[model samples]
Target: MIRFENVSVTYDGAAEATVQGVDFEVPEGELVLLVGPSGVGKSTVLGAVSGLVPHFTGGTLRGRVTVAGRDTRTHKPRELADVVGTVGQDPLSHFVTDTVEDELAYGMESLGLAPDVMRRRVEETLDLLGLADLRDRPISTLSGGQQQRVAIGSVLTPHPRVLVLDEPTSALDPAAAEEVLAVLQRLVHDLGTTVLMAEHRLERVVQYADQVALLPSPGAAPVLGTPADIMAVSPVYPPVVDLGRLAGWAPLPLTVRDARRRAGDLRERLGGQDGTPEVSVVTTAPPQPEAPPTSRLRLRRKARSAPTTAPPAEVHALAVRRERVQALRHVDLTVAPGETIALMGRNGAGKSTLLSALVGLVEPAAGSVRVGGAVPHRTAPPELVRRVGLVPQEPRDLLYADTVAAECAAADRDAGAAPGTCRALVTELLPGVTDDIHPRDLSEGQRLALALAVVLAARPPLLLLDEPTRGLDYAAKARLVAVLRGLAAQGHAIVLATHDVELAAELVHRVVLLADGEVIADGPTADVVVASPSFAPQVTKILAPQKWLTVAQVREALA
Candidate 1:
């Protein structure tokens, strides 16, 4: 029920179209997944469906885009609201109401639906998205993932014929993502609703798509085919597909079940005495630099030799209360020099709250938190800068300068570092980003890199990141992994709050699972994740009984 004919979009001042000659068709009742690297116009393509591209975004639209036989050019977003529902990447920007229940009912109210029907639809959406318990909570008090679900439910309550979503599951935990995706599946199969979604996390959604549309690169026409056909040649793919390709499996598997079905012989080949790989593969470390050791490197060497060195960060009986919500409860944790830890759990879990506690953003209601031998809550901002740093979930919150160059310069002054140190970190994390670009103009992943660069410029002993890979594609994520791994080896203790299990599997030395503001599981990465189906990475699930956590590990073992 959606068609794009000879489409191309160019912003007001740009030289070339962001997307050129893009043409595709989505049949009614089907879910079409738009796949591509960041900045390849996946968001732009999704915008065209809801008429946000040229209409509200101040861009020139070429050719035609029709949804449910209504031309988007003729019908503005408001006019098409009856048949189309769109959720952009930033859910906070999508809300007009204060509470969860109000937000879910706002769209129907705008559509002039009967009050009874609106109430019924709102309740259905709340139950469908697992937001029933949060119906009375204010939107401002909810977590990032909770806000995302509320945004989705707001759109879904209108009962539109078409759903256009951008990174719908980016903020959700594994189980919550599955619930949202399953709801979309039910819409497509039972209700004949159409869904067009663009996402960077292919592993979570690729197996559920009815068809796939690939935008290979910037300015390239989309390639449309079945999921398997697109994944085989597509530059970006999930870890399961990566494993299938590595194993030379014909007709690459899209799901863990399919991969496991074909993995019997391969499993035997890599199996060792204790149901683990014979050679333990180290996938997180980057190659050592050849340059002379810097002061930070020397400090790392000293810490390694000095076993009595204090941990970078320590927490005991930490409890944090936000209004009536007990965000964290009697949690205890520790971070050593040169160690990387992943804080993981379902949405509304205490992961972000714990990071906030360590960074001194939130004062602990009970117990104590110390970073670099000083109580975090009582430490001065200037003094804290030397001991710890934080890159928050919304990367934009850390950025304020007009240009990338200015931001780097400001970071250098703030951290008392060398002039080019921050820029150098940006270059390593995100290459080819020019200095003149505005922080607002960059893509989500690019902004995240800039924020990370600013935090790393200080050369703090303890580093904390929240959802660092939200907008990154596989290639960009690899660059991030390399940078983070290098930092961990240089005496920087890193703690990241994330829901990306693949990232946790590949980068973290330990996994700490939290639920309801309490730690539920804490142990080595493999020991913790391999035992939990919801938290295991694709490779670990595919090669069950083997403690492999990544495709690189499997490839290394086979070699």
Candidate 2:
């Protein structure tokens, strides 16, 4: 069991506490979800449980934090290794050996377990995670979802009583995220391993969690309860739950499958199954949102800018090498200047790898990459930085400034952008909290805004974002869409790699589905997402399973 009593943490070179005076418990075998906007101290909480907070992050933590009856402060990671297994947002953080088998065996080996014990555990994990086929594969070659599975496999081999994961699926596609979530569910349900996770994509995990601990927006306390208890109050509840509220269900449905059973009744009661869908739960067909528009920034494309470069937009196939992993597979791809393209695939599908390759942060193993007729590798680092701005899945990784204003200033300066222009842009992206003391201190949603604000400061012609809504609440996601719509309107080519089908459906002109370093489907967003039949489903796409991505689009169709 893991416990936190009035625990709060602050890091070095950081201004504020990530979590404050939060009391919680994770009994053996129970799955607990820690969710809030980005940087709500969720990650910090996980880190504390695993002894990474003070040991690795060098933070000043107050109150008591214990794991399995052991004081975390008294035990370092090495000491807690056998008792608890941990995985971070970035799977690359813990990878040691190159092969999947070696990775799985790494932990057991460290503990000096017998070869037989290690072998049996490794084999069990391989089968459990559905990684038996990839056991011989190189760690560098696995997709993000695959790598994350391997990470879990490696830890599970140790048979730790408790497991903590920090946004493990942030970089995965919806299907891939589903795959990982399924594995996690099995671990918690079948194996009786206690699971504590911090995730931004609550739609996928909320139902699976036995307990949901919601950290209020910055300056507030965390509210703890069952998933149903949190759904009604959480700004991050999925559409079905929102619809459940509209349908007047006493308690909201937690999972899509459960919601579907009663959904038909609500629809029938509202009107009929034949003519335009009924509206018992919500007033409109698409179910207009109760969230205030002010919580989000909604902007439609004003006009498409005509670029000097004519048709036959450049196709650059670049290579990327991150540490030991050659992330990009030297794949061929092209982007039309005015078109919005989405990079899709399972996690570690190399979507981010490919994007980084285009920017030259990821050195390619082979093939050439060019952006706007300029070779990315040959271009100056600063020039490449300005050519493309990437909003990584982990917002905190991108933020490091005294205030929101200062962060924006640094981005502008780095991009050689005009002074104060970046600050002006922050107003819309940040909205009400633009003037906040420290962007870091805001709620998870606000922090994401600040991070995206900095990335936009570069004002790059090509925008590359990785899961832009990783930790956002409902309001924050709408605001992000507005920002992207505004950028696309200006003819800024945007390529966002995400698992957010709803955001993609509304913002992307086209969706490029990738699997195993290959483009399996590439075309209009509606065609790609709605066309899938065998693949696992996403919430936004599930309820309607239509071509539309937003409530507005559904309403338009009904009208």
lDDT per residue for candidate 2 within 14-34, as digits (tens), equals 566756878878888899998
Model 1 ranges off by over 4 Å: 278-309
Clashing pairs in 1: none
Model 1 Cα lDDT, one tens digit per residue, 1-559: 9999999999876777889888889999999999998778898999999988788988899999999999999989898899999998889989998999999999999889999999899889989999999999999999999999999999999889999999999999999999999999999999999999999999999998989999998899999999999999999999999999999999999999999899988888886425685423233533322211111210111111112235778999999999889999889998877778999999999889898888677899999999777786786565555667788878888888899999898777666568999899888887867788788867777888899988787666778889999988898899889988888777678899999999998898888999999999998898999999999999989888878899888888778
Alpha carbon lDDT at 544, candidate 2? 48
Per-candidate RMSD vs. true structure? 4.5, 7.4
- The candidate 1 region of ten consecutive residues with least summed lDDT is 297-306
Clashes of each: 0, 14
- Candidate 2 weakest lDDT stretch, 10 residues: 291-300
Stretches of candidate 2 off by over 4 Å are 10-17, 133-143, 265-307, 311-313, 316-334, 348-350, 353-370, 373-387, 390-407, 424-451, 471-473, 534-548, 552-559
In model 2, what is the error at residue 535, expressed in angstroms?
6.4
